[model samples]
Target: MTTIAVTAPHAPSYYAASGLPQPARPALAGAVQADVCIVGGGYTGLSSALHLAEAGFKVVLLEASQVGWGASGRNGGQLVHSYSRDLDVIEARHGAAVARSLGSMAFEGAAIIRERIERYGIDCHFRPGSMFAALNERQVRQLEHHQALWQRHGHRELELLDAAQTARHIGSGRYKASLLDRSAGHVHPLRLAQGEAMAFESLGGVIHEASPVVRIERGDPAVVHTAAGQVRARFVIVAGNAYLGGLEPQLSGRSMPCGTQVIATEPLGERFPELMPTGHCVEDSNFLLDYFRLSADRRLLYGGGVIYGARDPAHIESIIRPKLERTFPQLRGVRIDYAWTGNFLLTLSRLPQVGRLAPNVYYSQGCSGHGVTFTHLIGRVLSEVIRGQAGRFDAFAGLPHLPFPGGRLLRVPFTALGAVYYDLRDRLGL
Candidate 1:
């Protein structure tokens, strides 16, 4: 079996930068039992905890660091309404009915986010505009097809924007056209993750911080061994995503892990209007995508670049700085206040992997860069499946997923090669 050592959560993320002060929670140091045990305290785990707890099940959540410590807290924060992969990809594999169901659930994910924000009164700077901007004619055609697909399912919340209309919304000429989905928007991810954690705790769910899961013994009842404690539960949910580590070796190399970095600039003042005039979250159409949006305080939190084969923060600023400058040359002199990197699980097909490693052992990961929305939805679907409603989760239960080539010692080399191919495509305007 392939093995990879685990790393701690990312440091000083933009989500951490924009939030209130946090207190340290004690780590797990003993044995415990629950109806369900969830590994990883990010969006998926927390969402599972909230739903299962509300359903009257005793849930225990284990976090290697703090809650929101993974990609959930360190993402680009663009809550878009779709799977990371295209609908055509889903249709080709799962057939028309299942693919259409998966597509609708993608929109349901956005609705779930909005519902949580309002119901819980989460003050995460919830904004309601997201635009999938296009850079070329091919992308424009793709966006129009996407708009029609969603509209056919009564998701009329989306509207196609021409070049002129797109410029009016984002105030950047980089995009030739775009599709504006009014139902989706951006959020302070850390705040939302924390709110879900708090809600889980309120419903009597137990959470242990700084408790890295070491291994799992699968049987009638599974045991989750942590560095300091162990959890025995009737059911186990592995929501670790790219940080699954050795918890489930079968899942370890299934998705390639690529590091994405972001930089938050010093507040742009009233000059924020010069960036995204419409205040809509924006992302370009490319494999190596560039996404940026202003914080509530007006700092432009810009992010892009895919680092495979290694975890190095030293070269992040140099690689992403020029990309930021190219997008808004007006802010060439703006100083970057914070820069950091987080890993996303990119699958071979760029879709999500949600199914069972064993009948009682469930796992969900590989959302590409689309986890901010998809993960939360998967959490809910996971809970439903656990409660004997597997129809929604089954749509994604079977799909093509190949493990990273070159095994443990060479997974990076192989993934880096694939990343280079995508990088070249992005540059050549493919």
Candidate 2:
């Protein structure tokens, strides 16, 4: 297993570059005992803490870095209703009643975000508007099918836009059609994660930053080994998704860390309206997706490009810049102010992994770039699971996950080969 310590913080990205200056959060210093110890302080861990703490469980959250320092801090920020996989897959795999229940929960995830933001008074620059842009005829057909599927599920917030209508909304002629979900929106992800952490701490949860869990000794009372200190808790939840390395080899094997990059352009002022005229989060239908949205301050926040291995900002910028240029040729000379990359876990089924590693050790991961809202819902569902009500949690927990073939050494190469075939099919419109 690859267990190199990642201490050196990369240069500030768009989220860090624009966010309010945060005080240096200290690392774990002394031993602690709690009813539950969370291994990562991202959205999943914080969400779990908020619910568990509210339910009167003593909670301690350990972060390898600062809160929201992982993908939770650095994502495309689209809070959509479903995973990358089609809904029919769930219906086919599970019974219709179970699939419908899970489907309702999927949409409920969006409501959870809205309720949390309003209840907590979190100002994360949230705006409602998300478009699934279809650039070709085949994609347009797929969107139509999805529209029907969602409408049948009584999710009527979706409205389909024709090529002309999509062009009017996006100010770009690239899209053949689009499905707009007004309830789903975008936000400053880092701010959202940080706000949730604040809420959790306000509820009497203990959070320790820069505290990486080195080992886990599972039993009636689990002990987590950190570099500086240790945590003994009745329950342990590992919420570190893609960035989680040797911490849980079995969980890591179910998914691989794939790198995705995003770039933020300087404030475009009047030109911002010309870029994304409708103020909607936009993503194309290609398998290797291109997603963009307007910043709260009216800058173009564009994200695209997927790399198999770890690379630096310069390399990420090189791969993504041209993709941005392709979308808006008019903004060719627009300088990118900040560019960075984050890792997201991808499962073969493309759904989240939610289950118990042991009776007391639970985990939820593999969001496939759709975790922003679902992770929060999973956290609440997990709290319910801990309370001995496991209906919703089991919808995902029942799904099986295969370890990547050839383990760590050859998984990347094998997945890269599969990704290449998918990329080619996407290009050929297969």
For each candidate, what TM-score against the reference?
0.93, 0.95
Query: Residue 232 error for model 1, in Å?
Result: 1.7
Best by TM-score: 2
Clash total of candidate 2: 0
Clashes of each: 0, 0
Error of 2 at 82 (Å): 1.2
For residues 29-127, could you state the per-residue lDDT of candidate 2 as single tens digits? Answer: 668899999999888998889999989999999888888888889898888887666577788876787678777787777788888899888878899
Candidate number with greatest lDDT: 2
Per-residue lDDT value at 76 in model 2 = 89
The TM-score measured for candidate 1 stands at 0.93
Model 1 C-alpha lDDT per residue in residues 1-430, reported as the tens digit of each score: 3222244554776778667455556677678899999999988898888889999999999888788887888888888877877676678877888777887787777788888888888888888898888888878888888888777666898888899888778767778898888888999888998888877877888888878888878887899987667899999999998877766777877777778999999887876465777788988888778998888888888898788743757867787889888877777878888898888888877888888978898999989888988888888999999999998888888776776666767877877777689778767767
Clash list (residue pairs), candidate 2: none
